[model samples]
Target chain A: MASLIDLANPTRFMRLSAVLLPWLAAAAAVLLVVGFYLAWFSAPPDYQQGETVRILYVHVPAAWLAMMFYSMMALSALGTLVWRHPLADVAQKAAAPIGACFALICLVTGALWGKPMWGTYWVWDARLTSMLVLLLIYLGIIALWRVLDEPSRAGRAVAILTLIGFVNVPIIKFSVDWWNTLHQPASVFRMGGSTLDPSMLWPLLILAAGFTLFALALHMVSMRAEIMRRRVRTLTILEAERLDRLAAQGAPA
Target chain B: MNDLIAPLGPHADYILGSYAAVAVVLVGLAASILRDHAAQKKALAALEERGAGRRSGRRAS
Candidate 1:
């Protein structure tokens, strides 16, 4: 087995990702198709939400992934600030936009689910509001990365921002329980066992797994792109410096 | 086909819209990531071919 430190090397990571990318993408695609089929056909409608319950298939998974990606980023932030892992800050930067997209999807789908069930498209409920905040944080992190031109400077800034912003992750998770919100309480992850039937639960879990794989595959690709982009910058700068040295040597002393 | 997959009933529009939204966002995200990856790969390969840097074909250890 490859050592963790060895895998952290950019060349090693690139080679590994090159081999793993196709398999990961293929698995994600297959899992998503199977999960969607089960969700649409196999799972029965809820007694209360009726056909609207179908929204849960996408909504739940998107929400879960949004939070999961943030947690991943938070850990990456630690690696950036603490260990100064070469890939850590790169991974965090690469993942922000994807996390933001997931959060946006969660918000939009949740609203779509909300309108039919709750009779309104928007609400200030704890779950909904905190989730919106989470989306904003993702956008903020992405913007921070863009505004700072220096990777080293941006890495530290983003690390600090990510760690500070992580307070909202737990808020998003516990908002429903902490407040008398319109959103339903935890049913699938509670200690008393899931209230959801096996039929519904299986599809939800499968879809969640598919989304996790999809996000990871995208992250891997994004990290590769970031690494290549950095390499290009370094090469361009080095070429310019070499030309300057040759010109200086040819000039009269 | 609608009958076979359990009719979405009165809330069909919402359900379909929710799924559509997810599909669009995820597909768009995937496309953007893949496009960036391709562009970066091409740029890096071009630079390496030009021998622009002494560090080409080797990691900065």
Candidate 2:
């Protein structure tokens, strides 16, 4: 088993991810299928919301993933700035769009769920607004990557931005508790214990796990592609330098 | 199909629409990543084929 430090090397990470991704993808697919089946057929509808409650299966997972990925990026940002881990910036860059997509899914699904239950598609509540802010922060980090042009420079700048944006995470989590919001407070992970019934909770848990594994698989592949892209950039620069030398020598004239 | 959806009540569209949207976003995300991976791999292979080797003398493959 390679140590964590050893896996930080891009080549090693690529080799390990290639071996693990297929198995990870297969397991995620299985779990998702089972979870969806149970959610649709086995779980009872909410007494108040009825069938609209079914949306919770997908909505909760997307919302969890959206926050989870941002937290991971914040850690990766720390690795880039503090430890200067080689693969840290690559991981952060690759995760941005993915996190943004999950956030978008969360918002859209929450709206769909909200309409039938809350009588409206949206509210300017703290939780929803903070979640939207998180998504915007992700988009900003992604744009920063493109604008910088140089990888190392972009990495440092985005790392700072990511750490600053992390302040919103706690606010998003505690927003409902601190304020009278339309969104419900934490049910599954409260300090007193989960208030959710086991029947519904099981499906939600399984689906969350499945989505997490799927996102990790996607992240790994994206990182591998980023590594290859950097390699291409290096080789192109080397090729250009060689042409410059050849021109200086006037050998090909 | 009707039998399956009938149990969802009058707001079946909302429920079904949520799931459908999730499916679309996830599928789109996966496709984009895979396409990017392929493109990068192809570019690296092409560059190496042109004798533009890495400074460390390591090939990506």
Which candidate number would show the highest TM-score if scored against the true structure? 2
* Alpha carbon deviation, residue B50, candidate 1 (Å): 1.2
The C-alpha stretches of model 1 lying farther than 4 A from their native spots are: A1-3, A250-253, B1-6, B55-61
lDDT of 2 by residue, A1-253 (tens): 2477666799888888999999999999999999999998899999888888899999988989999999999999998998888899999999999999999999999999998788999999999999999999999998999999889889999999999999999999999899999999999999989988999999999999999999999999999999999999988899788767778989561
Candidate 2 scores a chain A TM-score of: 0.97
TM-score of 2: 0.95
Candidate 2 lDDT score at position A202: 98
The C-alpha TM-scores of every prediction are 0.93, 0.95
Assess the local accuracy of residue B11 in candidate 1 as a C-alpha lDDT between 0 and 100.
78
What CAPRI grade goes to candidate 2?
medium
Model 1: which docking level applies? medium
